[model samples]
Target: MGDVIPAPEAPRIPIIDNDEAAARRFPVRRIYCVGRNFADHAREMGAAAPAGKADRGLPTFFLKPADTIVVDGQVPYPPGTTELHHEVELVVALGADAPPGELAPERAGALVYGYALGLDLTRRDLQAAAKAKGLPWDTGKSFDFAAPVGALVPAAALGDLAGRSIALAVNGEIRQHASLDDLIWSVPEILHELSKLYALRAGDLVFMGTPAGVGPLRPGDSFQATLDGLPPLSGRILPALA
Candidate 1:
């Protein structure tokens, strides 16, 4: 046999159950996202064309590189114009890579490591500017500290998350509410499609999208996201930089 190729390395994050512990470390990689999976959200974001137009087509996909993760306990709002927004979501941690194409629900479950609450922060003004120019959403959606994730809960501890309730609240006011079952494109389907384009690997995380009610944020503001059976994930938004 000739020389063998080395297997690709799996991304990894430190496993912590408390915020204090999580703050001391840096994330292994960052996989940012958008929550266009919800119909109401699609409409709110103008992604849904008029009823008969094209139905907004399909679930849109965008990406942010690995370093965008803000693991330092607090999310520092980026500088510039005011409109910063927050979208809470349920994060899926993969334990192993899945093959491309249609995957059985069971296979998808087997690949999961655990779940956590995550925030997909957006710079609304920048995003709008990009949209107006027909440019990609990178400036608006993939800013530094844009993806703030909570601790991992390990799959063995949290079983099939389908049909579970996921919600988020800001300063005691509920902003986003929905069920995992409401995802237009289910998790397995997402993984299948994503794998076809990029090899699915352990340590890779998916935001799985967010529900409607996405809006702006200001410094000193605090929020919390809760899944039916998981502990509530909370964070405080730091003032925007000068």
Candidate 2:
């Protein structure tokens, strides 16, 4: 054998534990996000989709690289915008192997290994400018420390989340509130649609979507994300580095 090539140094994503054990580290393949999957949220953003029912075709999605994910609220406030918004969402962590194609709803649940509450932090002003200019949302939505994820609860333990409540609070004040019942697409439905878009494999993460009441965040502000049947995720936003 010739000289073995040295591997390049790269960061891996840290995932919270469902049980009372140490967190697990996984090689994040992709960070897939569903846009405006909640009716109230869509309406707030002037989207045409309604909240209670599924819209025609697949839901809108965006991507973030695996390098941006951090466990819980360990990230500091990201720079580049005066308007940073907090969007709490239900995050799904896939564990089993899934082929590239349409995935059946019945078997979709089996592919999920765990669930967690995640914050889809965004630079709203940048996003708006990008939208107006017809540019990609990568800079607005995908950035360093953009995703603050909580502990992962094994899917078998979380079970069906039909009635679970998902909410976000700032400085101990409730800002966003909604239930999984209001989701336009359920977990399985999301997975089914996602399978058609990409060849999903083990360790891929999906941020389901957020409810209404999304708003801006400032330095010294503390935010908390909660999902019924899962551990709460809390973090503080520090001023941008001078």
Best by lDDT: 2
What's the alpha carbon RMSD for model 1? Answer: 5.7
After best superposition, candidate 1 residue 112: deviation in angstroms? 1.3
lDDT of all predictions: 0.73, 0.84
On TM-score, the leading prediction is 2
Candidate 1 — which residues are off by over 4 angstroms? 1-27, 30-34, 49-57, 100-106
| Candidate 1 vs. true structure, TM-score | 0.82
Clash pairs, model 1 backbone: 30-66, 113-155
**Where does model 2 exceed 4 Å of error?**
1-27, 51-55
Give TM per candidate. 0.82, 0.90
lDDT accuracy of residue 105 in candidate 2 = 90
Question: Per-residue alpha-carbon lDDT of model 1 for 1-242, expressed as tens digits?
Answer: 75499754433444544455544332344373545877777788887533432443555677876666654448877876589998888887777767666566557777777777778888989889988999876888887778777767766667777789988888889999998887777777677666656666776788888888998878888888899767677888887666
In candidate 1, how many Å is residue 35 off? Answer: 4.0
Candidate 2 per-residue C-alpha lDDT over 59-96 given as tens digits, one digit per residue, 9 for 90 to 100: 89999877787774766778888889999999998888
Please state the error at residue 175 of candidate 2 in Å.
0.7
